[model samples]
Target: MAIVDKSTLLVLGPAAWILLAALLVLAAAVWRLALEGSPAQMLVAGLRALVQLAAVALVIAFLANRGAWAFAFVGLMFVVAVWTSGHRVAPSGRWWMAAVPLAAGVVPVAALMFAAGVLPFNALAIIAVVGQQIGGAMSTVTLGGRRVRDELAVRRGEVEAAVALGFQWPAARLMVGRPVAGEAVLPSIDQTRTAGLVTLPGAFVGMILGGATPLDAGLIQLLVLISLLLVNSTAAAATLWLACRGAWVREPA
Candidate 1:
């Protein structure tokens, strides 16, 4: 069946709520059993998602005009992305630097897309495409930053040795951090490669359900995938560079 099927159960009404709650409960149970994860966290996250999506829908309806409101909302999203990504790597409060790498990754690609008309500069389309790219940047930078933090903590001696051998402190960090941080883009690469065969991504499926031809949906999906690669790779590299400069270096207790 096409994805548009199961409208009543999947899209609205009581069945949708029940099914979502059931799935969340099942996931929480499995996680709690295997990893002692907090089931409450899972439940809360689901609830938060429901509330946030509802809020987004209502807010987006008011942002139909192409004006300052659209750009302001996207700016808010960028700030949130930076904060969220930094929290993952810098629990000790050195997170503000996260904006650098994330901006480095997102700005260029977004400008290119806007300039090339790949994404129109309207409220809905701008948010949909730029938000996705910003999310990609956030995730990549988080992974890359965390890897740098962990590797430096674990391999402190290696970094120290390089430093003692007359290498600069930044270079020493780079020697240890680069290898691990570089793996940040691996997921994007894998997802792009196995996209249509293993899974239909949200953009492609959404467009198809919205009445776009399959070919048009596929092209859009392809564009999103390629753009994600650029965003992920650039963000990861910038994160690594920033980490090497001591942005996310593990602090001593």
Candidate 2:
């Protein structure tokens, strides 16, 4: 079907349902004292996210039909992922340099898969896989970046002491980097271990809902998970290398 002909299955009045769910969640948070924000901010953020997702959904559908548009959308996703991931990791103005490792992880694998015909050039599938890769890159970069920054900040004195004694940046980083990288891998490792037992990932559930065979859904989810693991590991390594190289250093002031 063409984009215009696709029906939005409004299960239980979309906006009203979302609003009710947000209200319920806000009420529960307040009742339980689970959060620190004003309920109004939560409500506003929920509404804004809903609006943004709706707009993105429409744009994605349109972009999926145009080859050039699909590539453009992928580029945009990568740029946003890099910026947000970098900001979350180190909070340095030079955090943008973290994009190098993020790209290092994503672009190589994505290019290989696309070139090898493992990932079809279809717009929808391309978008889906690219989005997953971007998400993986973002997660790795953000977690690893923050961990490294926090580690260095908390141990700067020790690091400086080592440096004073003639230890280099890479050696000083290695002293703390291993632990941070280990922590950064926990999310992916946990998600993989808990995939079908404790949680049903979106891709698998969506495929089942769309009438895919259980085996097929399982295989697809496996592919996604494996791809994510590789991407995350690569991104984490890249982040560590860049941070060690002083490319993403905190400001001296």
The top-ranked prediction according to TM-score is 1
Tens-digit lDDT string for candidate 1 (17-136) = 678889999999998999899999888988998998899888888997865588888898999998899889886768878898899988999899988988876899888888898999
* CA error at residue 208 for candidate 1, angstroms: 1.7
> Model 1 segments beyond 4 Å from truth?
1-12, 249-253
Model 2, 1-253: lDDT tens digits are 2222223323345566766786867675784576665766666666777797898899888877676677788888888887788777656568688678778888888887888777887778878988898888888888888888778778888888888899997788778776787577688989998999999998898888788999999988988888888888888888888777677865476
Candidate of highest lDDT? 1
User: Clashes in candidate 2: how many?
Assistant: 0
TM-score of model number 2: 0.84
